[model samples]
Target: MEQSKTNQFNVLAEKPVGSLLMQYAIPAIVAMAASSVYNIIDGIFIGQGVGAEAIMGLALTGPLMSLTAAFGAMVGVGAATLMSVKLGQKDYGTAQKILGNVVIMNLTLGIVLGLLLLVFINPILRFFGASDVTLPYARNFMSIILVGNVVTHMYLGLNALLRSTNRPQKAMCATIGTVVLNCILAPIFIFVLGWGIRGAATATIMAQMIMLTWQLRLFSNKDELIHLNRSIIKLDVKIVKESLLVGLPQFLINLCACLVAAMMTRSLTTYGGDMAVGAFGICNRFILFIVMVVIGLNQGMQPIAGYNFGARRYDRVLGVLNKALIFGSVITLTGFVIGVFFPTPFVSVFAKDSPQLIKMSAHALSCMVMMFPIVGIQIVSTAFFQSIGYAPKSIFLSLTRQLIFLVPAIFILPHLYADPLEGLWHAAPVADGLASVLAITLLVLQVKKFKKQMQAPVENMHTPL
Candidate 1:
């Protein structure tokens, strides 16, 4: 068993960087792409089968969903990053402890956050710009989603551990399975059963619940190096702190995203009404598909970068970062081409009967992705810092686009334009451009520091902020 575990992790340190990236990244990209497809499909079903109001209502739920995901990412991303470093250091015992702590933390946080959101869901939806017509749909969908929040958290957290433990394929399979199941269930519940918006939420939760059960069984196998054990299942204060600390940047990013979504929705609702909100929803789903690909690439890079950095393999770390940035840029640039030049076909899929909705969505989609060619650098740089456990740098980079640059742009830009809606559409690209410039500056400096450190003796070398 020990030999098998050693062989599994040894590849991280020994494999060629290009092949290793392909081996890890392809599965992750497929999984994230599949998940995004499900979201897009869900939007299609709701818009076509229900109404435009329903689509707007769904958009209103984005803020709360982001808020829920924030906590889940905090534990999952943090523990997984930490676990990779521990494995590279050959500290098997600590890695096992991390696996145990992840399960406990996710369960506790999930239940607590779910209940609090459910209790005040009504006011929350209203604050997110849900109107009389849209409020009921949003409320119904979130009620079911919140009730099954623990399932979502456990599924995501366990999947992250699976990737970090040299089982990226298994993690990918789990996500794909859930997405396929949701795709099948959604149509039946929404169209056949006439459950409406509530049905879509139910389908989502049920799929995640089924997959969460499978994930639990996988972790229960004692043969695995990082399997769950009753003895180590108790929470350790130190592990919890480190995990949350490492995960804080992602937490803030998502939390700030929640705030940004709320403000954007409010502005859209005030200026352009419910159809405008629906247009924003359509644009968001499309952009998310492209962004998920970049995130998947980063996920593939995380273990490699973290493991190599822990082993003091500066060259390997630099290699993976460069590859990731290049691939991420290519992916986002493709999105830019498609969104700007040919958005009609994609936007029309959701609301074919509503010509106004399609036109509005197509324009919004183009404006939002105007600077997407450079957006990947910002995302990849933030993830690079996070993977290496440089929490302060990661947190600052994460906040730059969402909180510092985007928030102000969203507020002030609209007032400056003759058409407030046009200003809102342009805010995203402005933030994207400014954030990417900062990312490039920081990355260049970091690379220079790494080069200087490479000249020193290995034993005396230390990671500096």
Candidate 2:
């Protein structure tokens, strides 16, 4: 166990930046890519086997899913960031406390949120602008998903916690396992079982359940440094408070996502109706895939930056941030190029038979990611703050994109343009550009602050006789 801790420290604290990043980021990217693929896989099967309206129903559930993820992030990301810093400080006891808190928090939030949503499912869907044709589909899928919400939360939270403990490979394996299981079950359940949209949702929760079981086993091992303990399982006020503080930024970011999705659906439904809503769903899936790739890079950066910062190794933290920015930018640029130039093929993958939906999605894809190249820097900067425990700064940056800028633009832009649908598509890039600029300014200031801190001399104290 000590050797394991030493190796983690050595790799995170001493390895060459480029090599260490590749080692961590590759697995993360694969895991994130696979996770994103599972989302797409559901869409593909639903669109191919079910109908466009079915996809729209799935789309309506975006806000609900985002809401669930928001709380899960609140627990998972919070605890994970805290754990990384604790590990760096060699406070193994606190790290174990965080692990216990994670399980409890996830279980509590999952049950509460799931039940609340299920109880109010219909009214919520109606408020989100779900038409009569799509309401049943949304309810069907969400009902099953809600039933297994605790499983979903536990899996996601544990995965993040695992990565923070320098178990990125293990985290990657869990997600990949879920993805593979999802792929197998989705087809069988949807097509062979003739269960339709509900089958897709069922497959999803089942896959998560299986992998979460595996994750629990890993944490239950007595040999691990941050393994589960019965005594630690009870809540600790300080651990809970700290975890929530660090996680608030991401929680709010996802909360904003839920709002933004709802707003887009409402606007799209108002102007373009069901097909338009479906088109946005396809576009969202593709965009999420790209974003997840960048997130994978950020995940790789998080532990390194968090640990080094805790250890007062400012140079290492800065090094990882710069490298992460470059790699993330390259990934986003690739996404932009593909989304702008070859969107039809991608959109076609989801809506092969629905030409109108394809056309709308293609246009939405291009417009939404117009500022894609700059986004890597923006996302990385926010993540950097979160990783280093600058929760307030991270929260501010996250809000700049989703709430402060995008929310207003999404509402105002459509009204300004003749074609409201085009305006809706345009709102994203507008927010992206504005938010990226703000992120750049903040990041520059942060870098300067880091430099000042690095140059400051350490205080010396003398003992008096």
Highest TM-score: which candidate? 1
* lDDT tens digits by residue: candidate 2, 115-204: 988999999998888999999999999999999999999999999988888789999999999999999999999999999999999999
lDDT, model 2, position 108? 97
Lowest-lDDT window of 10 residues in candidate 1? Answer: 456-465
- Model 1, range 325-434, lDDT digits (tens) per residue? 99999999999999999999999998888899999999999999999999999999999999998999899988988999999999999999999999999999999999
Which parts of model 1 are misplaced by more than 4 Å? 463-465
Q: Model 2, which residues run further than 4 Å from truth?
A: 1-7, 459-465
TM-score of 2: 0.97
* Best candidate, lDDT: 1
- lDDT of candidate model 1 versus the reference: 0.93
Backbone clashes in model 1, listed as residue pairs: none
